[model samples]
Target: MDNYLLLKIAHSLPGLLLLLGLLAHIFMLWKANRGGDAAVLQRKLRRTRLISLPLLGVLALSLPVSGWVLVNLVGWPLGQTWLLASSVLFLAVLVLGLLLAGRLAAWQALAGSPAPASLLRFTAAYAGLIVVLLLAIMGLMGAKPA
Candidate 1:
């Protein structure tokens, strides 16, 4: 197989993995929250964070590196609007993601204590923004405008 194809696969698989891992984490959190057991919630959140966070970090790092390699291989200039937009969006996602992870870790530290309503609200909003930004990044990548 061609090196470009391999790089494309490496880049694309991580996108799917990242999305699936996030959705799974969210679902687990929702389920844990619904159970109304603080201990269970904390445990679930910690487990999800421990398992998914590293995978996410790996995926996040690999996606850009593989993409950069593919862009070079294809001879697409880095200055192209789509590429630039995607780069900026990727940075936003990375920052927001890290913040969200930190928030989750903080929540885990609370153990059986109730979370502050403000923190919960902030987390929801932050997650929503990350989702929207991710979708936008996907769109920019697919459109690849001139």
Candidate 2:
């Protein structure tokens, strides 16, 4: 009904979707790789590169814009501790996301052959950190003083 409600929904929906998308990609890619069929894993990686990754990128990029608008809508000072903390965490998430993207590209490049375990490990660590940071940001957002 109101601008705040609409904006809040806009802000929240993408965050949830981004989380789910990351989890799904992790699971799907893991499954594909574990199946021990290089073609399946290659196809999965290519699909992720072509489709899911860009969608997730768009979702990730939309968050800060919506969050800024929502914060302004609520008239909350940007300097508040929780806001500051979440902002910092969001930056970390973005950085990790970029690193993860690079790793994914490397993985895709190696998809023709047997992928090395280290690349998967790094990607998993990055994704896991991103998930944890996102959850922390959600917690901070949910607990902000009214």
Query: TM-score per candidate, in order?
Result: 0.92, 0.96
Candidate 1, residues 49-79: lDDT per residue as tens digits?
8887887889888988889999998998899
User: Ten-residue segment with the worst summed lDDT in candidate 2?
Assistant: 108-117
> Model 1 — which ten-residue stretch has the worst lDDT?
137-146
Local distance difference test scores for all models: 0.83, 0.92
- Candidate 2 residue-wise lDDT, 1-146, digit = tens: 99999999999999999999999999998899889888888899888888998899899899999999999989988999999999999999999988998998999898578778898899999999999999999999999997
Find the number of clashing residue pairs for candidate 1: 0
Off by over 4 Å in 1: none
Please report the TM-score between candidate 1 and the true structure.
0.92
- Report per-prediction Cα RMSD to one decimal: 1.6, 1.0
